[model samples]
Target: MSKKQKRVLIRILISSVLFAAGEVLIITGSNPFNEASLFAFFLIPYLIVGGDVLLDAIKNIIRGQIFDENFLMALATIGAFAIGEYPEGVAVMLFYQIGELFQSYAVNASRKSIASLMDIRPDYANIEIDGVLKQVDPEEVSVGDIIIVKPGERIPLDGVVKEGTSSVDTSALTGESLPRDLSEGNEALSGCINLNGVLSIQVTKEFGESTVSKILDLVENASSKKAKAENFITKFARYYTPVVVIGAALLAIIPPLLIDGALFSEWIQRALIFLVVSCPCALVISIPLGFFGGIGGASKCGVLIKGSNYLEVLAKTGMVVFDKTGTLTKGNFKVTEIYPAKGATIHKDEILKLAATAESYSDHPISTSLKEAYGIKIDRKQLESVEEISGYGVKAIVDGKRVYVGNAKLMEQCSIDFERKTTPGTLVYVAIENSYAGCIVIADEIKEDSADAVVNLKNAGVKRTIMLTGDSKAVGKMVAEELGLDEVYAELLPADKVNQLEELIKQKRLYGNLAFVGDGINDAPVLAEADVGIAMGGLGSDAAIEAADIVIMDDRPSKIVTAIEISRKTLKIVKQNIILALGIKGIVLLLGAFGMATMWEAVFADVGVSVIAILNAMRALDVSRYQG
Candidate 1:
């Protein structure tokens, strides 16, 4: 509880005791109204509990905001006092205050859940200055400066490890429980806990540009972007409160004048009850609170929803489009197959070694895979006069021999008649001195959870799941078939991906939206063009994260299903609160107008419904167990 809440709680306890004693005295005594001392004693407790509400009502009235719940509550209680129902007036105000306290407490608790995500911000960074380690603010650390991280300390900036090896816990950033192992030359992002070793790291980004700071900024400003449903409630209350106030006035006045048997006092009492029950407190408080809770719950599960508006859009998603490389697949290439031509006398390992040696100076992923497959250090001194062909591959002189490594086009240009390998992967053609050597096939491995992600999304009511990629048709078709995707588009450039997304958006069902998931720098345009852009944040580029509407911190495609489920469940709770509040209020408003209901029922209709709806909204916070 906050300090203000603690003080309000104390006041509630004190006032409840005094009110109980006053009630007993009133029942035991002859006439409390005739006794000035007893009347003043009861009024003291009333003011003690409800002074803030009364003061707020008056302040708002002066500010020209007269139709809010505070005004309704204050007016109804004062009306009770006017009618000489002092006990009823005091009890109504007391319960109203209690309801407000409950609301404040619930809101604060939900804020804490959302705010816990901000704990990743580091308090300080450790930098060595002339052999002396000094602690300073992370903002003071510059790029390229070497910083040291000890065991159990958070890495304060994004950087590369220069020395030492350790396991770092990334659960706070990624929501994955496993600790990632890091060694020299490995990259380490901020907000990760260095688990077991003292390491020296070269800072690559300043404090503001780090991943932790970016996430904090995104979360802190999220609430400013309201969902469509929340905006409706705001406008609904603006008009609804004033219309009810006018209706209560007409009920109190026109009925007494029109009906022959209607007494002014009875109709006035009904009008007071009407105003109390008419306050739009339940709808106003619970709808946005529910969205806020949903965002918090998603963050707990390693998904960052940019705003409530995006959450609303995600619930309406019927189609999901995916990028191939780093999204559904691991993005790491491996040499899975090798074929030697009939006349080539080289072994499979020899073919791989030649390709690895020729591509030693290249930093492409395919190059890396070839090097890794060779499993031996390359002698860079043997590679000479390397030239990169933009549309194909590299040409290098290896060990005093002219070696060419590229696609079929390079071999065709070199006049080498090579046997074309038809496979669902990237094929590299190697030619020695214009003679066809062999081919090495490298393929990207799909993620284990990707198939499950497709199934779960389908089960969650997604109409279609599609894959878009820059790979060949065969490779795209192979992955699509394995994952059971509905459609696949291959050999698309960055702009083509956006065109496909636009077409998919047009194909969506009326009221349904399209979501695009990606994890590469080239995917940024498509991510921004889709209705909901989801990024794989763990290994995704900064451009992708900046453009995406939601980020899966762990880079698991299955989390998209979890995110969709959270959105749907949150929308369900919001709709429930709306229906429950409106239904109960509508029925009781009729009863109160006809004199069938009393002031006690009016209090329940106003504060009781609000408390129930608020409790229902709280359910959106516990969505960790919600699975598609």
Candidate 2:
């Protein structure tokens, strides 16, 4: 318990002792005081337990805010004291204090749970200056600076390993226990711990732009965006409290006047019970706590939901659209096949060498694959001039021969007749001196979990699954069929992807949501246009991550299923709390107004219901049952 809660507990113990002593004296016929003096005796315990509540009520009344829980509590207990029910008034305040203490403890535990899940923030970066290691704030570390990470420290910035090899634990960032081994030239992200070897890393990004910083910013601001259920409760309490107070007042006055020989004290006691049972503490506190716990649970599964609003939308997702490259596929292209022209004397190695040399200056994935296949040095001196044709290919002069390396469009643009090949992988046509040459086949492998993700989404009751890609029709169809997607739209540009998503949005169910997942910079527009934008954060571009509403930190498609499960569970718990609080209060409220209930029953209606609802809200934080 917090120190503030500790003080409240001490006050409750002292007040209970005094209240019990007064009751014992009265029952034993040994009361030392008259009726007025006995009331004053009980006032000591009442003020001791509820002084802050009474003061708060008075302050709020002065500030034109007289219809809150504090006001209801203060009015009801004070009315009890006025009618010679001093012991009941003291008891009400003591029980209310106990409920408030439990509330404080529950909120604190939720906050600590979320704090521990996002505990990846580093305290300092180790930089070597003059062969001596010095610790500095992460913000002070600049790009290109070589920082040292020992076996037990977190990588403070995003960088590449320049020296040493180590096993890195990314469980804090990805929620997966498997450690990745990093060697020289491998990229190391922030928030991962170096487990064994000391590593020297050349920083590629500053602290502000690192992965850890972005995640922290997302989590800290999550509560600012409230779910619809939370908004309803805020408005409900605002209007509900004032109306109940007026009803209580009318019950206290109108009943005594209408019924013959009705005693004022008896009806007044019923009004006080009505007021106690009408406090909206359970609905007000438990709903938001449930959503907060849900977000923390999602972070444990490597999913970062921006706010509760997005979490709600995720539960209603009926359609899921995916971008092919870097999302469902590994996105690592390799030279799978090399085809030589049928009538040409050029060998396969010669075709590969010419294409690799002419396209050596480009950094595109296809170009990199060709260079990797050649596996030899390219002499740039043999090239006279090189020109790039966007969306086609490259034209260069190698050994004083005109060489054109690109797609079929490039071959046609140069007016070179080439053999057309119908292939399932990407095709690159090579032309030399305006003559036709063979084409190379490059392909990207599908991710191991892509099929599993599709199957799980279907099992989760998602109505449709689709893929939008810029790849050729042959390649896109192959991947879509392999993953068992329900629909596929291929050979689309960036603008075309958004248009397709808009058309899909029109076809979805009226209240259902559509989620678009992508990882490239080109996918940013389509991501923002979807009902929920999910980004693959592992190899995803910054533009995609910035526009996305939810991020899968480890680039696992399976985590989307986990996020949806968490959202549905949270909404179910919140609704359960609402019904549980209102159902019990409604029955007791009717009984209290009709004089069928007493002060002890009223305390149970308010304090006991709130404590039970809070305990139920805490269950949203347990996600172990959902994890495989």
Candidate 3:
């Protein structure tokens, strides 16, 4: 706990004990109304509960930080005491202190929510060297060094497994709540807990570049990025306290000299009631509490919002655009079909092996899939004189035989006539020793939940869902139709995506906010250009998190709908609290100024409204109970 919290807790305890003792004495046939006895019965508990506020007011008087709520509350209660209303004075302080303690308690609840997300961060890592497990800082471990991950332990780094296999639980990172199978040559990331096996992994990234550490950093700094609301109460206090103080001074001095029936003390008493009623505590206390609850709730559901600014914008998003590559697809290419064209000489395995070897030195998606499909050992040493043709494909010599691998254009240039086939994905033809071989069709598979995500967003009141991709129009249309998208803009470069966003923003309906969801490195510009940028499938990419406004931590496209629904609900609660606090305070302030209400009523106007507003703000944290 912070020092301020400890001090507040101690004061509450002291007040609780003193108040109990005072009640006991008053009930035990003691003479309690005497100055000495009444002082003990009322003043002791009041001082314990409200002494810090009084002290703070005095300090502010010395430091020229006067005219705040502290001074108003302190002086009003002192006026109550001067008028022989000891119990009323004591009640105000007690209620105010209870409100303060509840404020602290609410903040602690929100902090606990943030602390739960801190589970992904590891305190230390185990580095294996020469068959020995040595404890070391993650930063000191280099690439290719084998790290040991034990059962019930989070993976400390992103690495490829060199030994052993395990069912690793990655729910913390993905929120999918399923354990993924891992074995030799499979990749694993930090924040995944080992379920039941000992695995030796070759670290691929530096500790500074690990995914869990970045996520922790994001969650820690998310609040700082959120912009605050208008803070209407603090603004009211800024002007109200000084105005009331000045008006009371005028009433205390000028009115007594002019009016025949007016006593300066009576006007001063009225001024004290006015001050007590105008503390502006309700708005000041509830706005921050509402945001704390909202952020805490989002963190629990695996949606990390950087600040209140994004939270506000998320509520206004009208059109949500999705990038077709990684955001809407699996982002991994797989062989969907193997077609040996009519009169083709080589079979499926021969075609796959030739293409895999010819494209071995390339890093494109189709090349990687071809390498995986061969099901044979890839010895780069055997394929000598390998060369990559920029944006076209590759040319290499496998066992002294010239091999060519690329699109139909490259194959046509090499004089290899391979018949075209009906395929919705990227297809590559292969030529072995200048002889025409069969084709291997590789397609970027649609995400498992893409259709459901689109449907859910529509149900969540999103008017339009669009897909923007660089792929051919035919392929883009096919994917869009399957996912039930409203529109598809294909063959778009990075600049073209921005153009589409501008057009959508111009034609946007009621909310006037358009969102673009993407995960590619090139989509950073578009992410920044949109009104609300949703980065989907952003597990380990820093660029996606930095450029986007809302990050779907688990890369689920459906989270976009979840975030919007949560934002809509949270914003509704926040506004309700604001209206509720002001409505109650406005009526009570009028009654107190006319002398129809006591100091006790004024205390409720100040502290009672605050407590209710705070309770309402807690609704933002209960998204599961509220969000469908």
TM-score of each: 0.64, 0.61, 0.61
Candidate number that wins on TM-score, 1 or 2? 1
| Models ranked on lDDT | 2, 1, 3
The collision pairs in model 1 are: none
Winner on lDDT (1 vs 2) = 2
Model 3 steric clash pairs: 222-306, 226-307, 226-308, 227-309, 537-555
Per-residue lDDT of 280-342 in model 2, one digit per residue for the tens? 656656766677678778888888776566777888899999998889987777888888888
lDDT of prediction 3 = 0.72
Residue lDDT tens for model 3, 86-188 = 6556656665565555445543432323334344567677986677888887778898888898888889898999888777865445422224667788899
TM-score of model number 3: 0.61
lDDT of 1: 0.79
As a whole number from 0 to 100, the lDDT of residue 592 in candidate 1 is: 88
Better of 1 and 3 by TM-score: 1
Best by lDDT: 2
RMSD for each of the candidates: 10.3, 11.8, 10.8
State the TM-score for model 2: 0.61
